[model samples]
Target: MRAAAAALAAAVALTLAACGSDGPAAPAGGSGGGVTGDVTVFAAASLTESFNRLGEEFEAANPGTTVTFNFAGSSALATQITQGAPADVFAAASPATMQTVVDAGDADGAPTVFVKNQLVIAVPRGNPRGIAALGDLSKADLKVALCAEQVPCGAAASKALAAAGVKLTPVTLEQDVKAALQKVRLGEVDAALVYRTDARAAAAEVEGVEFPESAQAVNDYPIVVLKNAPNKAAAQAFLAFVQSARGRAVLGEAGFQVP
Candidate 1:
């Protein structure tokens, strides 16, 4: 009887050990589903408004999870990410910028295109300068602000201008779309070439002018999870959330073309 009892106890111990070993594995392919933690996103300045809204929705959907963002020019953000910025995800205004991160071996996988944006002339609410088309921005009398050639918006502006055969000399070369738009909003410049979404975001202060040439320079926005993310699971979750139908709706409302 004693020997039988000892064997039964040993069996019970083995069963307990096996049960203890059955904890869930790390999220499959780091694609988060049951994750709970802080998720940090490094995104382009152009994504500020829409991303902020999405962050709120993401947090609401995942109790005990928080979403944080570092919004700046895509180039600047890319540089930071490559230099080891502690970001779980990176969303860029252009593929070129996203390539920087992928080239640095920091991105977990190929970036996915989430949306597209087109350039628009941001003029004061009343079109005070009588700007009507891309060529109008070239007028010597019109004070126009443009993004620096290094930024995505600036690059798109250059493409659109070339497509329209318009040679423009900007009064100011801002580093980001928001800065260029600010020049128009503050009356520092009569107009600026900015993203349609940005112009819409600042509709109270500026009006968007859609020029046909802008179609030639539509910018594709891409997003990816970082390979060295501290919260890989949460990062995956956030990325998936952004690609969901709800995410597309938010982007659509912000004047972005869902991909």
Candidate 2:
């Protein structure tokens, strides 16, 4: 009886050991239902401040994931992406610019409008010029800066100016909104037409003037994942985070209108 009991006990131990070994294998590094590695994003210059904050928040939420950014004029970024620049995502200040990527078949899916921005006349902190409206920019004595027509801010500025029936020339045509705003900040120009959110971001250096014509020139901001993304899983996750409630809150704080 003792011998039989010992054999049965040994068999039970072997069965238990086999069950433990067969239970699922440990998750592999970087591929176990979790995002990992780097996600590269190409975004418009206007999104610099808000997107920077969003990038930090995304990295914190996903351990071992890195967020890299390339911020520039939406038109420029679109050219780069179409020319084969490796990027995981693209966020543009205007649907027209986003369409460039879509037309080139570089976007993985249809881009979504995430926010809206309007043109605002940015001036020195003290409003020394007394520039109250779009017509004010037409004063011959006033020097102004504007973004290049290829840029979203510049296009919006054109629309606002046309809407207001103002035919003013700028002292300089910058490549991006920040450059135009910089001209105002440095006092090189009396004023610049920039996005309301940008003026708010640089509140310490400039003040935004609201004009009725700006209502006619609001630009829609769109974002999409690249078709050839190296880290597609992480890219999709980052896109989701940008459209999430937390993302809307951060953008709202930055003065972007949720779409």
Candidate 3:
């Protein structure tokens, strides 16, 4: 009886050990369905309004998660990311700017095109200058504001101008699209070349004029997760949210052409 009882106890110990070992394994790099923590996004100035809205929605959906944004010119943002700015995601206004990050291997994978934008003439609320087309911007009397050559909006403006055969000397070159549009809103300049979405966002202060030449300069917006993203899981989740159906609707309402 003592021997049998001892054997039973030993078997029970072994069974208990086996059951303990059956528990779930530890997660790798904190990845999985339960996405938490802060997600930092570096995006273009043109995406300011739409991204802000999306960020709010994402935070609401993912409790305990916060979405932070650094909105600036795509070129400037790219430079910042390459220089080691701590960002989980980067959304550029053009592919050329996104290439800078990819070239530096700062991106985790190939960037995906999220949307497209086109240039437009943002004029004051009342057509005070009677500016109708790209050609009108060439008039010496009209003080026009344009983005710097290095910025995506500026590059698109250059392409549209070239296509329209219009040589324009802008009164000022801004670092981003919003700054250019601000010149029009503040009555500091007669008009400015900015993204259609930006112009629409500021519709109460300015009006957007679409030109046929804009078709030649449509900009493809691209987004990517950084290689050293602190919260990779959350970053990926936010990226998917931006590419999701709900994200498309928000972008569409903001005048962006979602893909």
Question: For each candidate, what TM-score against the reference?
Answer: 0.87, 0.87, 0.87
Candidate 2: the clashing residue pairs are none
Weakest lDDT window of 10 consecutive positions for candidate 3? 23-32
- Expressed as tens digits, the lDDT of each residue in 150-196 for candidate 1 is 89999999999999999978888988999999998889999999999
Off by over 4 Å in 3: 1-33
lDDT by residue (tens digit), candidate 3, 134-252? 99999989999999999999999999999999998899999999999999989999999999999999999999998999999999999999999999999999898888888888899
| Residue pair clashes in candidate 1 | none
> What C-alpha lDDT does candidate 2 achieve relative to the native structure?
0.88
Q: What is the C-alpha RMSD of each candidate to the true structure, in Å?
A: 10.9, 12.2, 12.3
Residue 244 lDDT, candidate 2, scale 0-100: 83
- Ten residues in a row with the worst lDDT in model 2? 23-32
Q: Could you tell me the lDDT of residue 208 within candidate 2?
A: 98
